[model samples]
Target: LDPNRLPRTIDGLINALTGELDDETLLIIDDAHLIDEQPELRALIERFIMAQPPRLHLILAGWHEPDSPLIATARLRGEALLIETADLLFTSDEAAQLWQQAGKTLPVDFDELMSFSAGWPLALRIALDATNWRSALGLREQKSKPALDDYLEREVFARLPTPLQRCLQRSAGLRWITPDLCAAIDPTFNSSELIAELRRRRLFVEPFGEHGVRFQPLIAAWLSRRAAADPEWVHLHRKAAVYFQQHGDHESALYHQIAAGDPAAVTTFLPLARTLLAERRAEAVLDWMRRLALTGDETPELIEIQAAALHQLNRLEAALATYRRAERAFAASGDRLGQSRCLRGQAAIYLDTVQPAPATDLLRRALKLLPRQCGAERIELLLMQAENWAN
Candidate 1:
């Protein structure tokens, strides 16, 4: 179909297609989910699907399920059948048949081979190629994280041009692609050209909507590892921080800025650190902090983050010491909020040490400095205030 000839409205498009479509017509739309972003278009598609034109084969391929509610209705009514990842799994019978085509008889434990594959077609292919399926089956496992980095690196990423690889690397952390975000990552970004390249190269990038796309997680992980050591990694993160900040995403901005080792990273990271600590995610926060701490220049923000981590481990005295240092830095910088946080931290240590007088004084001072509107912080201060007097 010609681009200019394409209908401007869903009704117009459906009417045109209705006149043209008949038995033996096969319609295919790759990345169909992207086209499903428009409510009107999705509605049209649902009607088209419900009609189920006689002898017409229609395919709407995408990584995700169709966005049409009618598709769900069709499924519930037994008018539509879904062939998903599970159905694509190679059964022992299918595998044996394929092996027979290659003149090999069924081997023992073939079902065991299928079991290890868990219906993943690629895993099955790899196992079938192995001389010993049992050994291959024994080595199979589920990973908490994606384990396809090496395979993708060798088979896909390594083959790309350096500039494209770098582009993908810098953009990996993003959940979706838009012209604005791409431009934010690198001002030289040309959305149409990059999208065209991705499609031509058959990369894992998929259309998210009319003007959006997303990287497959495994591909993103692989690119992240590949670009981890690049000198531009921090600079790229800094750019990302600016973008996120401009877009009103302070939390994400803080993460990228922290990675960039900006002095403000700690101040921004503190509340999140406290939240993670409270959530019992102290270990994960520590791992994140340790990795970010590698630059070896500890700012007040880093100090506070470390202190917060220490507090989670109940290393009271050490946390108190670090908090004091962070407090002085905040006071000197005229950052009342930061100073208030440190004071609260120190007060907690004092109460734990059975020193109520000093703890009470610290809490009172912090209460004056901390914003009254902060619900969590205010609640924390109130609890600590009560505990200080009780002790």
Candidate 2:
């Protein structure tokens, strides 16, 4: 039943449509959010929805959560169907399918666009519609960005309360936001009431996991664009870094520190990289080192971390080149330990690439440079030779 086309009563509409429905008919009401404008019509639907024929499914579709008494009653009776934006959003795999169905070559930035859109339905639809998919892979590159932003303002962001609006703008730089995380960034987040209000309104945030909530990516992206222009954005990232550090999520902590753009961000990453590498998160260690060292001050140890990460990701050519760079830097700096580590990184790539003779030679050099105790690297090299000969 719709606002304009209802049969004067909910019962009348049901009786009129009953003869037309099948045993498994599904009825979807689009723009169900519009029901809020006609309170009597919403009440009529709420009163009769619970007893809708068992075989006839009723689906209400809306961008914002429609305020209907039926929602609560439906939930209390276990007859409700709640389809969230995340549920409706297109997945990356689905996006790939759309690409093939459209008969277009996959864009080089396919993964990047998938992440940037966070699988929002509208964004995916827009990307899929592009005549030049490669050029439109970036959200900003899409000519319809203005249309998307305007739609967001009308259907999403404009519906949020004032306090939540401010919270979103201030905390946009954060990837994941919870009440506690916002409290860490914004001193004025007096209570979780702001969160409660958003929940009550059924806007931007999604109650995720057992005790967690996440911002809808499209809404969060708009907030981030606003946040990036604010002077407090740098301060926000710094606060997030500290919070992540306290929680022992060191990888995220280091990323925020880098985003903070403090001159000493480099100093923080170097030591953190050692811990990360020890934890076998070589990719993160390498990324942190490379990003922090981009302005200047490329350390031998950082280059070694890069080599280790590339090796872990199986980019043998790049890893081998980085290992050689590290070896030269270490030799110039007279660091025997650094030289030995570089040799090991090179040897691993050589073995993986089937250059067994070079792998054996690097292992010999590493063992000779390493002290007699040699430890794990020595044991690793001996094992590599054993495996090589066995093959």
- lDDT tens digits, residues 285-337, model 1? 67666655632136666677777778878888778888998888888888888
Q: Which lDDT tens digits does candidate 2 get at residues 249-324?
A: 7777777887778776666676776777677887776566666656212788778877777777777888888889
Quote the lDDT for 332 in model 2: 97
lDDT of each: 0.68, 0.72
Q: What is the lDDT of candidate 2?
A: 0.72
Give the C-alpha miss distance for residue 57 in model 1, angstroms. Answer: 14
Clash-forming residue pairs, model 1:
266-301
